[model samples]
Target: MSIREKIVKEYEFLKPEMIKTIGELITFPSVLDEEAVETPFGKNIDLCLDKALEKCKELGFKVFKDSKGYYGYAEIGTGEEMIAVLGHLDVVPAGDIAKWESDPFKMEQRDGKLYGRGTQDDKGPTVIALYAIKSIMNIGLKLNKRVRVIFGTDEENLWRCINRYMELEEKPSMGFTPDSKFPMIYAEKGLLQFNAIGKGESVVLSGGGAYNAVPDKFQYKSKDLKSLEEKLIANGTKYEIDGDTITVFGKSVHAAVGEEGINAIKMLMLALKETGVATPSLDFISDYVGNDPYAEKIFGVLEDEASGKLKFNLGKVEINSEKSLLGIDIRIPVTISKEEIVTKIKNIIKQYGFEYEERDFLRSLYVPLDHTLIKTLRKVYEEETEFDSTPLSSGGATYARSMENCVAFGAVFPDGKKTEHQPNENLAIRDMDRAFIIYAKAIYELAK
Candidate 1:
């Protein structure tokens, strides 16, 4: 059989083992922990990283782990040029365990889908890519360049894992990360996270899943719970009314694509304004920001052919007797400068007597469509899938932006449902099989 055919046959034979490996990785609650010193992120994350590297070693690949337990990589082949397959092992915390149909940490197969926290996001994709490399090796294909599978542990948080990895290792010649959509991505928008803080009255508000996910539930405390309930009923929102508190429910999705999910914090803020308990922070958000997913009021009609329009997500909100803080996440267009976006945001919030502080910023990534790496990956995708799709752009930030000559090539297909950062996140078994074939072919082509 041809090498390609051999790769496919091996992948089919090893599919069950691949599924089992991913399921095993999901059992660890590898969420970030600030108190842990030796592991930094947490013990579970450290354990997950160790297990991944151990698998690499078992497969006869050279594995390396940093002393700090931030990042690790497994490599094969021997050449000056290296192709990196970047993926993360860390997952976001499972918010509201009752929301899941099965245990988020325990992978359950039903209707040909694997239900778990890290199934679709990174862990599953990471394992599948590793197995692809193993399949290539099984075929005894000698590559012209080395292939490195880099595992990161802090992608769901601040990306310190990647940051530390870059500091210690040399940049790859060219590479693609399998953590995004298929047909490949050529550009990703800039990311900006900031807090708009201002003093408020007796109102106290707190809710959200994470900085990267839209808040699905929000709780508000005040003397006007009855009025808030009435407004919520009129608006047709899902909510719970206690004696002096109201809990509002909204759909959660990745902050990168905020338009896909409802922002519960936004709903609560609007309700507060309607009930006459509007603070300056609430007034600023309600009037200036409103419920629009795009920041049209702040920056009118921001868009470009590449990376689409600028998206916004009010991911979090915290209100107390001292000050009210609104955590805002913005995906700016690649062509826009940080100064332009930050200046406009600061100018608006400063007028409301609120202090603006930027927590993090990831610059935009744009590589020309005609580049060699983009063309090679796109050709491989079309050849494997028989779909003539063009390279795309995204608002989601990936490790692709952390290094030069890199883009996010997917484990996610174009027609697949997006469950990243959503409740009951899952990946289909059929999709995993297809992605492995594509990744194996791409890696062989790149390495050759």
Candidate 2:
């Protein structure tokens, strides 16, 4: 049999193991908890890293875990040069338990799909990449470069996991992360996350979790919120009330595709505005940035052919008697300068008595379409899926930019299910099976 056929045969037998391993990872609820001193990410995240490395050892790959508990890696093949597969194990908080069909931490298989918190985001893909390497090992493929699969614990928030990896670990010659879609991502938008803080004493409000996910749930309480609740229903939103506390529901997707999901913070503010509520943050949002994901209302049209349009997302919001704050996530198109965008934002937001303070920034990434990393992955994608190998530009930040010559490969198909940050997050079984084959062959070609 050919190398591809042998790898496929080995993986077919490993499918059950693959499911178990991915599910085992999903059970960790490895959300970052900076307050936990047991490890850099959190107790659960550190334990999750330990479990993942244990799995690597069981798979017979030489494994190493960072003493600081920020990252880990499993390696095979042998050479001075190394090709790497980097993915994160950390997940965003499971916002509301009632919204989930099953426990978000426990993987559920039904209707040929596995549902869980981290299934489609990074963990599932990370495990698939691991098994792909396992399959390659079963066939004893000759390698000219060492193949390393690095696991990070902070892709959802700050990429401190990757930052620590670069500081201590060996850099790979070239690699791909299976954290994004198939066909391959050649360019990624720059990310700008910040808080817009100003003075206000109008109303009390707060909501949201991660800086990169659209806020899908918000909780607030009031003595008389009946009018606002009616407005919420009139707007066709899902909500719940008990006593004086109310929880408004919105759709959550990664901020890269921010427009696809609803921002719950915006929903509450819009309803509150109708009830004559006033706050510095709420008033600014109503006047300048209602519902439009591009922030075109304020920034005009920031678009480029390489990376599509700029995306604006209100991931968080808070207002009180003392102050008001807006936690914003912006994806700037690849061609746009971050400085230019920030300057315009400062000038405009200052008009509302708010100061923009940057929390994090990731410069855009681009690998030429003709580059070997892109071409080889494109060839493999077309050959395996029979899908067109059109290179894609992404707004989601991946670890591809962390290394010198790395690009995001696939775990999600071009027309596949995308439930990354939302409730009922899941990955189709068939899609993952296909991804297994693609990953094995891609690793073989890249390493050999």
Q: Against the true structure, whose lDDT is highest?
A: 2
lDDT of each: 0.87, 0.88
Q: Candidate 1: deviation at residue 119, Å?
A: 4.1
Candidate 1 achieves a global lDDT of 0.87
lDDT of 2 by residue, 1-448 (tens): 9888898789889989999999999999899887987688788998888999999999998999888778999998789999999998999999989999999999999999999999998999999999999988888888899999999898988788899899988999889988887877779999899999998666888778688998889888999989998999999888999899999999999998888998888888888887887666767888888879898978899998889999999888777878878899999988889999999899888988999999998888888777888888888888898788888887766778787678888788877978899999999998998899888888888888
Predicted model with the maximum TM-score: 1
Single out the weakest 10-residue window by summed lDDT for candidate 2. 200-209
Which sections of candidate 1 miss by over 4 Å?
Answer: 12-20, 23-29, 33-35, 92-119, 196-301, 312-327, 347-355, 414-427
Model 2 off-target regions past 4 Å? 95-103, 194-303, 309-330, 336-357
Using all chains and alpha carbons, the TM-scores for the candidates as numbered come to 0.74, 0.71
433: Cα error in model 1, Å: 2.5
Candidate 1 TM-score versus the reference: 0.74
Q: What's the true lDDT of residue 168 in model 2?
A: 87
lDDT of 1 by residue, 31-85 (tens): 8988998777999999999998987898889999998889999999999999999
